[model samples]
Target: MKVRTEMYNMFDGAKDYLPVGQTTLPKLYLILFLIYSGFLALWAYICNQQRKNVDKIHLVMGVLLLLLTLKIICALEDKRYIRNTGTPHGWDVAFYIFSFFKGVTLFTVIILIGTGWSFLKPYLQEREKVVLMFVIPLQVLENIASVIIGETGPATKGWFRWNEIFLIIDVICCCTVIFPIAWSIRSLAEASKTDGKVAKNVEKLTIFKQFYIVVIVYLYFTRVVVSIIGAKVNYRYEWVAVAAAEGANLVFYSFIFLNFQPVDKNPYLVLHELEEDSAASAHMWEENISLG
Candidate 1:
């Protein structure tokens, strides 16, 4: 009886030193995200195996999904630690690194969808490529700044100022790619005639436009709404919302992958190849049956 009472007193004392917050919701969302990511990875593997030629887009998307899954896991684990100890140590840096890569992969996915590789190469410029290359590096710098600020003052609370700055930069970068892609699709849809091939192209672009719009909305929810709420309320709750948002985003990407597998069958790729083949055949026939 004496030992049990002493142990209980010690446990009570330990609780007084622990951080305060509920972890159940964050944990639940993390589990869901993990399961979703696992399924997506399996689907991507199957997609690659079924294809006559391996699809780079699908492979890349799969890898990105896995990376994002790792990011979420690291983030939640870090949060869990913070909740228990009132401070983050190692997992904090791991979370930031995964976050950096996830952002880069997301940008790559957007580029792949906006411009089918061979046909749309002419539309993209060297400068745009350079800009894309810099996004991850800039994000890395931002993370470093955030960490330095966070550790120097009230730990995570010190990041409030940097968070807002980073949010603005993120919005700008997302807009640069998203708005132009939306505009280009709209232009294509308007220019397309009501013929079979052209109509098919328009249909595909319409779907792409819808997907892009949803993505923009999701971005707004994550970057704007969550940021605002986190600033006003507890950051832990904000993480719960973020986990849910990320899970939904994963679903969106999965839908995109399922609907647009094999890349070659995509209407844009099909039409472009058809036109190129027709032109080649026409030139060959003219050469063979020349009329002088």
Candidate 2:
């Protein structure tokens, strides 16, 4: 049996166009670019029509989608360069740059959403801020390892070290993302008993549980299942593994946007703030307490 690929002419003075095991990348990336663009546009429309309901968290989601779209375009261009010249000399830098920002923004959105920030409340806990502080630096190192791994191939002495570092950091980040979700579920369960909003808390608990499950499934598929597939597959079928990973990503991002997109809500339920007169009275009480 023979698999036909787009091989360059022998007289063209190039060894190969697309790299081995990556023949499908251009088409895959192009399609993803279009799909991501559609998501970005749809999210933008939803936000525009519901302008009064928009919040900082909605802006973060939009940024995540925009980053993903730009990242895919960079990937497409890089693949095109690879297709024509057998190298990603110039375009891979852009891809990695977007890749870094995308990773950071993605984790920010994930952690914030997991804790119900700007949806259930307007503030983050100190511990949550600590998570963000660490994640940004970790993302930087992850992308650095990725670029090094890609540029050095498997031949360099430190290639194995970088690969291990990349995997460890990735697994850490994946694990980190789920804890906040778990915390939210537990908090909702406990709050239902104490907050005098049992029904509301129960509804949110169900949503949080569903979100936790989605995150676990998404991470397992992308990290564990995809790795197994790539490891077991023939080198020639690497494209299949890549496609599976990207497809999972597309689905994951789409689900996040759909599940959590902004909509009009009762201000009291969403913000947890007192009515204006009550708020003013509370402020006076606080001031009197402080003065006493």
Candidate 3:
């Protein structure tokens, strides 16, 4: 019970240092809720606009988005219990349960998003392919981190060390995803300068892409550096730093993933002009022109 009290004090100390006028997990939860909700709405809109039927991937993502929302709620409950009981160890088993759910929810989301992006290769340019390849590994790393988190327990003696390892992997993934995308977007922007309308769409998309990438990177570094400092300073607010680090991911992914969809390939676009001309001449004067 004494350890529990100390843990509550730990939470209080962390909460005190949160963005002045804000509670720690609750604030983060509210923001995440809004972000995910917006994403769900956007996905629905995209689904409606799709010319063909919604595929299994879209259906899966829709389901995952809902589960992630539930995870936010569970995280809020954990935060509340910790705040009230001051026990970060485990509260009647809810701790492990919540951690497991959060891990699974996030892991599923990251994998699905990455998989969906890869499916978009038909529509992606060569530079996009490079950026995507770099992103895929990072996303896999993040998923592995989540799996590790789910396997470890808060009260386990070596849990913190394992968690730290997961965090390191997470940071690596976030950095890889960010810098590669940023560079690719910059390249696309520069190349598209002479093309007008298409260029404008690319530029607009690039802006948000760059913004989210930078935001993810900034938050990742901020959380990582603060955690290192917190560990060194023996600060009572170390959990706060951890929360901040995790929060960065929650926000960035929720925001950016909404705009991602599985791109369809245009078979016609792959044909050369010469092939098109030949096909046209071959079809000339024919009642029904069909390519075999």
Candidate 4:
């Protein structure tokens, strides 16, 4: 009789603690993220090990996906805890850490894609590396500040906040990357007119450029516009919108990887090298004839 009474009391307490009107969408998104992350990690490892020459961009992208997967998982766990316990916990800190790393990795992937390995190497050695190092730390510091100053719960007023300001800064950084990417695409197009090899390579790069632009648009819509809507309405299910957006982003990334599987097998690799060799040979032959 005593044990039964105790069990009944515990059950009642748990019932009382359960969050009101909690939805399952966030949890569903987390499950999807886990599956995708696992698949991507396996795929990335196979590509890195099996390929004759592994592409650095693939490796970086794999790392970025993994980081994002971890961030989502942590965020999901944090949300679960809050719903069950009606209070914040250490999981929130884990979410923040993973989120910060994911952001950094995302930017790194963008830079790698925008410049390509050949150009990125020298650019990183000169000015870009220093700028990135500073920017990442500052962005993290700003996020921490926003957390401290902003409301603990969902935004109840306008979208404009210290955090939103940092998001604008991030948008500007993405815009800067677009300029370089656009220039590279234009240069490739011009070179393609005379060089068939360059044309083939340009086609491959165009696919990547299209993917990048789509992702940028998605980011702006979800990260900026959705945030504004959630804040203005103080939606009870704001996390659902965020989770849905992230799930969509992951789906897009998965589609890209599926379409462009195995970087080593890309025709661009061979064509790019051939074009470079041809250019070098032509220059050398011209110099020799002039000297003779």
lDDT of 1 at 97: 80
lDDT tens readout by residue for model 1, 137-199:
666665665556544544556566776676666766677667446655765676554333454
Question: Native-vs-model 3 lDDT?
Answer: 0.51
Which pairs, if any, clash in model 1?
Answer: none
lDDT of 4 by residue, 134-186 (tens): 55766676566455443343354443565566666666665655654565566
Clashing pairs in 4: none
Q: In model 4, which regions exceed 4 Å deviation?
A: 1-22, 118-138, 149-161, 194-196, 228-236, 259-261, 267-292
TM-score of 4: 0.71
TM-score of every model versus the real structure: 0.69, 0.85, 0.46, 0.71
Candidate 2, TM-score vs. the true structure? 0.85
lDDT of each: 0.61, 0.81, 0.51, 0.59
Tens-place lDDT per residue, model 2, 62-103, is 998999899999989887776776566667888888889999
Ranking by lDDT: 2, 1, 4, 3
Clashes of each: 0, 0, 1, 0
- Tell me how far the alpha carbon of residue 193 in candidate 1 is from the true structure, in angstroms, after superposition: 3.9
lDDT of 1 at 47: 68
